[model samples]
Target: MKTDSLVFWWRSLALLLAMGLLALVLQPFFGGTIALATMLVGVLGLLAYHLRNLHRLGRWLNDPGPETVPESYGAWEAAYGQLYRLVRSQGKSQRMLSAALDRFVAAGEAMPEGVVVLDSQDRIEWCNPKSMQHLGLDRKKDLGQHIAYLVRLPAFQQYLTAQDYSQPAILRNLAGGDSVLSVQLVPFDSTRKLLLTRDITQLERVQTVHRDFVANVSHELRTPLTVVGGFLETLLDLPDMDPASRESQLKLMFEQTGRMQRLVEDLLALSRLENGIEIREDRVDVRSLAQVLATEAGGLSKGRHTLRIELQEGAGGVRGNYDELHSAFGNLVSNAVRYTPDGGEIRLKWRVEDGCGAFSVEDSGLGIEAQHIPRLTERFYRVDRGRSRSTGGTGLGLAIVKHIAQRHQARLDISSEPGKGSCFCIRFPTNRLLEPEELVTSGQ
Candidate 1:
């Protein structure tokens, strides 16, 4: 190519000089030409040189292959080199930009929250896969579609057109149903927007539960507080009232206070259980536990009901935290005593079935309805609120029992018919049950 460029320049100069000299030398032989002819030949030479360079530049523009480019000599050489450098620099810049854009897209795809790119008109340009899951959108198919048209949520439509977007907007039913999304839009350069959406369904549910729990706790505390406050005011005002009347009022106040204390205790116990306290799995003597519960139940009943205790013969006790089992068994017995009518029969039984241990309290009481049975173990749930309050029940006994049973890998089974009876039982897994011979051998 260099040789070609040199040849091209050499030919132009040689041809122009040859024409000029020939014309001047033949002035006498041929028709005499003027000095202006030589000057005209010089101008023709410059035109020829420019045409050569233009031809080479045209070829490069057409193909621009990896072959060597012509190396121009003299004045035009510097200009040619500078142009090549500019072309190469622009190519490098383009490749680097492409790579950076790919990386940016990958990062957006991996994000937990949804990301969407939109034109100034809120037309979808690009979206990440997370956005598909969050907004139930088809990334490929939904491209170029108006976001407002696809979302169709009133809150989202309002947020999209709102001039100020300093804060996020909560959009319910974003993916339909109860789904909730926290969506925010950031405008860039007044012509494009970046939309971020996060699925806040689970978080919202937790917040709701917290609110309900707070409200329920407040309500539970209010009643006893009102009772105690009223009774105290009466006692303070009546300095010379009847002694028996005063005694009754004070006694009622004491009972209400005691009820509140029991409630607080149960609440604390439930909190500990919910927070996942580890329980010791030592072997528990079911027979002895049942016997102790029977004694407590009899006392609570005051012989108003027939109480029976039965422990299966030649069966080893279950394995669990001793205090937890004791408390659970005691609660069952107490619930029976509390709910059963006077002269009603209550039976407490501990038995081993299929290598599993079970403790059941069967009571001939006003039994729970089928629908209420499912929520019996829910904290503060009650079959009959009036009866529960009358019996000094805190409504947390069954909840506590459930937590204990679950911690020990057991299941509480209930069978009841309203006006007939209710049976509350806990079934311990086979792993927790020990045979009598194994019990003696293990010395537990």
Candidate 2:
């Protein structure tokens, strides 16, 4: 068969031939029976040698390691050497394959999305940690379990049965709590599949918010547009209408247009604030700014309410965009003026508390409920829609204030009790506060 085998057999045959020749010589010297006995002994010795080598080979095969290769003489040596080389090569190849498999597993573990490998029968073969979290699967307990049984959503089951994986399936409120998952089945090979899942909860929230915002904007604009359009149509129809009636209609139209204009301006301001525009780091004079806001509040109140301004001595300035801070402060003061009843007191204060500069607008108004305070900064959120519209509020003021506070690395703290009054404060961090001495030095 093999060259090594052939060499071994040839050597055995030569030895036998040599023994036969010796037997012939012995037959002449001794008797025929003695020569035959000598030949039989030679054959038995050869058999014993071969049996010993075979036993060694068998032992080595049972546990073949680098250091466990059996030593041999003649043709057996060559055979053992070949086997040793083959075992070492196979060991090297197996180590490389194991390393590659480990790297692939590590990569899957590091991914943010979930990954589940399924067998031909849709049974769980393996899954990464993220997949376990997304799908609520346990590696030890859930291995070999069918995917459909674990994810019991009817839509997912339908998608699986349909076998048309062209588009991904969406599951909302998965695990019963506002979690959205996008599940997709991919057939990677003939007998297995890849079940990929991505958590799109935040994405879904953003889309919902976007839809609500568009609808709200449309609703807000539609009323004023309808009013203006109606009045225009009436005026066009009544070409020879009385001057007094014409004047009244025009005034109403003008007010509606003004309201629309304010809404658009507030919408634009909110967009600019949310779009991450670069802010100017101006050292704003809070004392002078408070005085200006007081004056403006007095004008807005128009003797209907009492106004008070309190400034902390040596409170100095805050470092931020002056325009944004002014707008935020103005919004708080204006809202106070609008909501506070006649004879109600409105106080504007600039002070330092806990090593941080703080500006607060305290108002004696119809205070907000505790639940409404958390979402007060959401765009177009109103506590009383009718009163908010009547008071000329765009409903985006607090949202603007929030973005401004965030830009300046500040916190907006709101505290209010029903019928007691509301206090809205923007607290600047210690780093953003310029003390009196620092301001004076900078001025010098």
Candidate 3:
């Protein structure tokens, strides 16, 4: 090893002093052997220490280094320190990223709509809580399974193959009863896809109702107008006809005109109900209203049918527009009289049940089937079109009843069996039911 100037000068001084002492004493080997041995031992020990340090540095460079070292260790320690800090920073950043990802996943799981992630092979990689619930998925069994196999819906399978990201596809959930879903496929990364599902059962139902409403309205109007037009043409051709025949023709024309007017009025009422227009709410007495309806129905029936009243004593009154409630109840009673055969019994009942006021009309007429019961209140829906026409029904009676009941916060219950009889009941909510004192004071 090369020595510094100070070490070289000190060594030189030591050697000179040793030689001078030997010469002054005239001794042949004065201190020469001792001095040589001491110098040799000192130099060897220094070399060994330097070699060990060099070996340790080599090992550190080959493997991993310590976290800290003294500054005196020079470039080796500085380089190692920089590397350690860089690794530590990266580890902290990775932990933060992992935490953020966990939060995102948790949020998605809590959503109401379904979410699914898929790989390039169309295999399920991950799914959220809603997805499992909507699809009835068993996570342990479904993981890594082909999406088509698990879902098996034709629309969803087609969507996956089509790779069309512009629009979503609608699929019915066969596993769930009568549930519908709108599914969308989105490309995430180069090899991954995101499948989103939203429930649209209610929306679909509304759309269907809209479509049926338009068609039924058109048909109902067209039929009446056609009959009126044909009758007018016949009258024009028979201007000089016999007086008796002319009278009968005029009577028929008047009946058709009345039917048309009623149909138009019912149509207007339905429109108003659908648009949520505000109407005046007044207290209506069911007993008095039923009595009035019985009188009107009696006139319509010409006393051919028996009209019976079954009023419960002190039955609370309903809160609604008087005219609307009158029309609704009147339609039910009149329809019973018109539809029932001659001498048939039409019973009108008013009572309070379970803290709610209820009005029921029971008639011995042709009963409705179970399948038709749900849609009976739909506008212009006729179970027997020919019978409805023959009876001069506007085909909007039950629809009007349904609307009025809904507006008054009442529930309509219909019970009928084939060839037996039908009962239509309207139950008013407690809030819409009046106290007995109020009913008595109102002269109802």
Candidate 4:
């Protein structure tokens, strides 16, 4: 009842008392029956007015609003005003709640991680867009459906049954492919649960790579260290050994140390590149660089292979760090020299292809298989580990070249066949390339 309701009943009682007094005052002028009859009519009229007001109030309540609040007299007027205020206040609160809900839903939809709301029965209540993608859920079709039935992963089912959500469960290939998800259930409000999922595919890959890198580095260093240690022990034991045998053992030790040193240097170079070391942007003369590479390749080849240098007339230059580019180009040329058979031809070319400046090393040597080309840029990836070691390759040459290319906003392109030949090219975008006139304008 409204606070004004008491006023309404009090006012009604006061009017009834006044009517009774009027009936008593007219008792002598009329007669007892007439006066009583008059009082009864007054009472009936009051009852009819009250019933009519009640009917109006009931009708207004069916579609209650400030404009639709029924108007009345006396205390009823105050009652209608209070009821209208109450309805307006409730409407305002409902609107505020609705806006808050909208904002919360928008935030959830924009989140990167997946979020799903579940009822006490583990049935879907709502899910964000990411949850739909991560869990392969259909919002329209999957709502009110059991989450376990849709997910259908044994680990997930077991996790739900366990109900011990102290730790998250890792689900692999949940949505198929190589995808990984970290899923956890958080109980809220006694019955409802919040199902959170995060894509961990890249994280898992990075961890695997980290583990492999550590293992590979350990294995690579252990071999040479063991050989060096064994030789030292042998030499210490046999100090009176023949000079020829001693000299040979010393040379072997020197080679192993040199290999280890090279590996360390390559590792450091790769690290620097990966760590985004600032590059010194300078105009690098490609023609002169090619000649230098050719000379170095010839020395590395040691008359075992025929080396040739080709320079396109308008190939011009590129804007990049001179030493980094030199290192990149040197790696390609050296790789060709190392891998090619005796008397095989290694051609170093600097040319402008499709408006992009390109430096290519083509070798008629032991070529790589097609499948190995994709992973060639991975550190220490070798098609044949023994052959790579025998050829004095650090298995980081291509990886280094790739990083250098990326830093310079260029790309490394490799094409090879098993028997015929291989071509490795670093193509700099047109924007990075300088025409002959531009090079001259820059006083390079």
Better of 3 and 4 by lDDT: 4
Clashes of each: 0, 0, 0, 0
**Candidate with the larger lDDT of 1 and 2:** 2
Q: Ten residues in a row with the worst lDDT in model 2?
A: 435-444
- Candidate 4 matches the true fold with a TM-score of 0.93
1-444, model 4: which lDDT tens digit per residue? 545778877888988998899899889999888889989999998899888888999999788887888888875777777888888899999999999999999999999999999999999999999999999999999999999999998999999999799999999977666899999999999999999999999999999999989988898899999999999999999999999999999999999999999999999999999999788788888887788888888888889998888889878899988889999999999989888899899999999888888899999998999999999989789999998999888888999999999999999999999988899999999889987665532332
Q: Is candidate 2 or candidate 3 better by lDDT?
A: 2
lDDT of each residue in 1-444, candidate 1, tens digit only: 465456556766776776777777767666555545665766776787778888988888786533445668654575466557666776788889999999998999999999999998889999999888878889778999998888888888888877678999998865557888899999998789999999899999899878876777787889889999998888788888898999998888888889889989999988888889788776777887787788888788988999998888976787778888888888888999999999899999889887678899999998888998998887778888899889988888999999999998898999999999999999999888876654432333
Model 1, stretches more than 4 Å misplaced?
1-110, 173-176, 188-190, 352-356, 413-415, 437-444
lDDT of 3 by residue, 178-280 (tens): 9888888888899898888888899999999889888877777787678778878988998888889878877877887787887888889877877988879
Q: Rank all candidate structures by their TM-score, best first, as comma-separated numbers.
A: 4, 2, 3, 1
Q: How well does candidate 2 score on lDDT at residue 266?
A: 90
TM-score of each: 0.72, 0.90, 0.74, 0.93
lDDT of each: 0.84, 0.91, 0.79, 0.91
lDDT (Cα) of model 1? 0.84
Name the top TM-score candidate. 4
Candidate 3 — what's its lDDT? 0.79
1 versus 3: better lDDT goes to: 1
